[model samples]
Target chain A: AQTVTQSQPEMSVQEAETVTLSCTYDTSESDYYLFWYKQPPSRQMILVIRQEAYKQQNATENRFSVNFQKAAKSFSLKISDSQLGDAAMYFCAYKIPGNQFYFGTGTSLTVIP
Target chain B: DAGVTQSPTHLIKTRGQQVTLRCSPKSGHDTVSWYQQALGQGPQFIFQYYEEEERQRGNFPDRFSGHQFPNYSSELNVNALLLGDSALYLCASSLLEGRNSPLHFGNGTRLTVT
Candidate 1:
């Protein structure tokens, strides 16, 4: 079984500032996928970004990016120019082949004005 | 394009009662997945269905079952509900085996098992 861990339970960042959420995972599979999802107060889950294990280059999407260190089994999300809308619960997920998903406990992010 | 959708935005059930939740996949998506999100927790994968068959399932018990229709819409059935079964159930859709095909999610069905 694969398990994802988010050591930080909560985080805060001033608006327009930057923040990073840490994530670690345990897996024996050689190929897999990692993702970061955000759930706002409305309770809707939204995909923030994703990374493929086979790729060496980290994935970046505008204000969001990931530092994926496969050998260390770490995948962390970085949010730049954080906005109030970025305040939410952030999740780190693991997906091995066969399409099964494992999620971390999550980190609650708060963007302060 | 319309995104994934789930019905019964909210539901209330008692112990031993049965409940059915529905989902419609995003247009052009053939695979649908279900997840259970307990309050203050991340979503846990419940199962995945494709082409009217269950392709994979998570650690959930047999009481949690699902079915996929030809149109790629899906249903999640839970029997003998327990307090532990209370959650916000989410439905996600993706293209089968497409590299980097991320799953888009619905708002979710909030089930409160009393």
Candidate 2:
């Protein structure tokens, strides 16, 4: 079985500043995928960024990027130039070759003005 | 595109009662998966439907079942609902290709079992 862990329950960042959310996972599969998802007040879960375990280079999407350390089993999300709209609950997920998707407890992000 | 859409954004049921939640997949999507998100917890996979058959499931019991239509729409059915079953039910759509495909989610239906 695979599991994802988000140590931080809540985080806050000043507008225009940068913030990093930490996540870790345990999996036996050598080939897998990692993902970061955001859920706003509207309740829609949106994909933020994704990383392939085989890729040594981390994944970046506009302001959102990840620091993936495969050996350490760590995948963190960094939000640069944070805005008020970035305030939401962020979830870290893991998926293997199978369709089962495992998710962390989630971290609530607050962007302060 | 209209992403994924779920019907009855909110629902209330009692113990021993049954509930059915509907989900319409995003345009061009052929696979649908269902998840249960309890308050303050991440969503947990319930099952995945492809080609109108249950291709995968999680640790949930037989009480939880699902059906996928030819149009790629899906329904999650829970029987003998318990108070513990109260949570937000999410429907996600994606291509059946492989893990490379990301899931597009719908604003979940908040289920309350009283």
Best by DockQ: 2
lDDT per residue (tens digit) for residues B32-52 in model 2 = 999999999999999999999
Q: Which lDDT tens digits does candidate 1 get at residues B1-114? A: 898888999999999999999999999999999999888888888999999999988889999999999999999999999999999999999888786688889999999999
TM-score to native of every candidate shown: 0.96, 0.98
What is the DockQ for all candidates, taken in turn?
Answer: 0.71, 0.84
Consecutive 10-residue window with the lowest summed lDDT within model 2 chain B: B94-103
Predictions in order: lDDT = 0.93, 0.95
lDDT of 1 by residue, A68-112 (tens): 998899999999999999999999998876576788999999999
Which residue runs does candidate 2 get wrong by more than 4 Å? none
Model 1 misplacement above 4 A: none
Worst 10 residues of 2 chain A by lDDT: A93-102
TM-score, chain A, per candidate? Answer: 0.98, 0.98
Cα misplacement distance, residue A73 of candidate 1 (Å): 1.0
Instruction: Give the CA lDDT, 0 to 100, for residue A57 in model 1.
Output: 98
**Pick by lDDT: which candidate is best?**
2
